[model samples]
Target: MPSTPSIPPWDVHRPPPGHGKVFLITGGNAGIGYFIAEQLSAAGATVVLGSRNPAKAEAATASIRARVPGAQVRTVRLDLADLPSLRTAVEPLGAERLDGVIHNAGVALDDPPREETREGHELMFATNHLGHFALTHWLMPLLSAAPAARVVTVGSFAAKTERLDPDDLQSRKEYVPKRAYGRSKLAQMYFGLELDRRLRAAGSAVASVVVHPGGALDSLTPSRPPVHVRTAGARLRGAPAALLVQGKDAGAWPAVRAVLDPDVRGGELWGPRVFGLRGRPRRERVWTHLTDASAATRLWDASRDLTGVDPGRLP
Candidate 1:
């Protein structure tokens, strides 16, 4: 890992005017994703929202259209829990060259007992990691065709407390809901860094970066009683915690910076400056272990096996 990772400064709250760039944002119908789509559209980019609910997707785009009257926005169906649905979702947009992908869709499984997806993987890992993995693989061609394309994935500060458990990648043996979610988010951050390494090694032009909201308010993660209790406890300790930290628009800033900042590099991480709890967008270095080459190689192999998609073969 570089002794000092490049941390670019940017005004994420206010993006510069776009020149008709094409952007695809998953989970764009609500919360952070919705705000990201809205901001990008307002900047004059052609926005495509990938959502599971047709009504929600339509509503999201409509809302953006209302605000940015004539904003170029479209909607597509995407269900991260179902691998087959992901494949079907990308087919329609495969032909178009994409400028960037904001992998904002994810799920936090707080339910008791471990749950699996249609592909038999742990629910949290499936939705948060594998789903985005498969989507990025399938869309590689579109990403590569662009002059300069980017792939930004949302991770979390909770990743610091979690490590990838190869033995229980699916959380089958020991299932701790919050821990599982953290592990999955950790996997995402790892994948983003590792993908950047591989892309540089393979001489691919696509740039990959990861961002964390640093305790932003997200609807994607469930806010059950236990979660709230823990959050309250943190606040009592002067930790500056919230059941959900930043507002929806503010939460989207880190990701927006990672995607739009011209100076961003592969493996770079952007997040809030304050104790990683909540603040404005700022580039920050991730833990050294996350850049472990060996772990990344193992993860790449595991992801390929799980998704049955070879990213190397992508255009």
Candidate 2:
């Protein structure tokens, strides 16, 4: 085993021309995802936006076109909640060689006790991990088609404080809004590392990288609370307070860096360098336990069972 290499913060680098690369990003309609797509398109990459809402996706594309004046950006329908939709959503995209795939779609809320998706897995786990798992499994051929392709999965710092309960993955025994979210994020990071290992073992051309945003306050954060209570709470907290929240552009930097940085290696985790909370991107070591071979294998098996998608069958 060798020591992991570290990368400097985002401000240390300049955006290089993307030239003829093709990039795809999930949840590109808003927030961090949209910002990433904007930056990539501005860099000259052919960008494809994947979202559950076609209307919102169209609007996002329009906004990008307005900014870049003929930016090559398009949209595809993808709903992480529905496994069947995942298959249908990506079919029309055609099997073109891809330079990168940014797995950024996610959902978080204080909902009722553990709800399962049509795939029979916890909702958050299904969307945050299994959905991306299935997508990556299907896209391996396209990813491998490129001489050098990268798969960047958006993770979170919360994964550091959470642990996966193999027996209670659905949280049937106990459930908490924050815990569920954290666990799903933990799964995301683990999956990225494991996928990289498998790719290396098979001598594939794809490299897998994981990144976290620290905490970039977004519209999604405010939507967590009930509408009426959320309003009153905002009033008590002081109006316009949330307006000072961290910008999504800063949050998206790490993902962009992981995807496009020439020095980035497989299994490298990128996040803020300051307080691991908010700042520019930097390559940092994930918690030691996250790379534990046993746990990674366990997670890989669980994800395969849950999603019914096996990486071995992929190209």
Candidate 3:
């Protein structure tokens, strides 16, 4: 693929104004997703928060409205783990075109015995990878309807050194909570790149970009009332970690840039600029593990088999 020409670095504070665009962010009710919504809303984009909990989504919407005054924000009930409901989950999004979709919602099991969704897929893999994959299939029409649309997949720094086992993608043979989580995220990154490749081949206007939030610590994050609260003691304790990490708000910069930056191209990776951990967003080279076209294809094929949806077919 041809390399994208270099452009001026994006200023997080002054993102290109998004007055007329509409963006849907899965899991936008809290954490980094909340910050992504807040920033884009501040810039005048109609931001929709997709979450399983309506009340929490409302709280996030309220927080953004309070902070951004005339911000246009809405909420849609979405449960990625519940595959059958996804088609209906997006019904509220309407027939209007969608400018962007951020595949940011995910689940991480810290310890385990491993769990499975009602559909019998591993919890982490189902929610983190397959759910977004299925959702993309449903949302393609809305996305393609736009003059230019982008899909930003939020991956994890944990997946940097993790490798996926094609034979055990669901961790059926052996399931370690942390490792399972990492593999799930790695699958998401693969999907983003693969989706982009398919888009380019099909000559679609929509773009798919991937990003990772580097060391986003809640202790260092600022409070947003009902959405999140960081105590003074927490701030003091996290001050030391600040040298190498950033708050969730800062962690959201890369995804926001991927969505709004006109110069950003598909099949590219974005992350924190400083040591890939604690600075402004910068376009990073695609990781080696993520560059394996064969693995990505296998994963894509497996995802389609599991979800029964082919995202490559656009409307």
Pick by TM-score: which candidate is best? Answer: 3
Compared with the true structure, all predictions reach lDDT values of 0.80, 0.81, 0.95
Models ranked on lDDT: 3, 2, 1
lDDT of 2 by residue, 100-207 (tens): 999999988677767778767788988998899889887777888898999999998788988888787767788887899999988889899999989888888799
Instruction: Give each model's clash number.
Output: 0, 0, 0
**Count of backbone collisions in candidate 1:** 0
Tell me the tens digit of each residue's lDDT in model 1 across 116-213: 87678988899999989888888898899988889999998889888887777878888889999999999988888888877888888898999987
What C-alpha lDDT, on a 0 to 100 scale, does residue 26 get in candidate 2?
Answer: 94
Error of 3 at 162 (Å): 0.5
* Maximum-lDDT candidate: 3
Cα TM-score of candidate 1: 0.87
Q: Which regions of candidate 2 are displaced past 4 Å?
A: 1-14, 219-245, 312-314
RMSD of 2: 5.6
**Comparing 1 and 3 on lDDT, the stronger one:** 3
> Lowest lDDT 10-mer window, candidate 2?
220-229
> Candidate 3 lDDT, tens digit per residue, 95-164?
4899999999999889878899999999999999999999999999999999999999999999999999
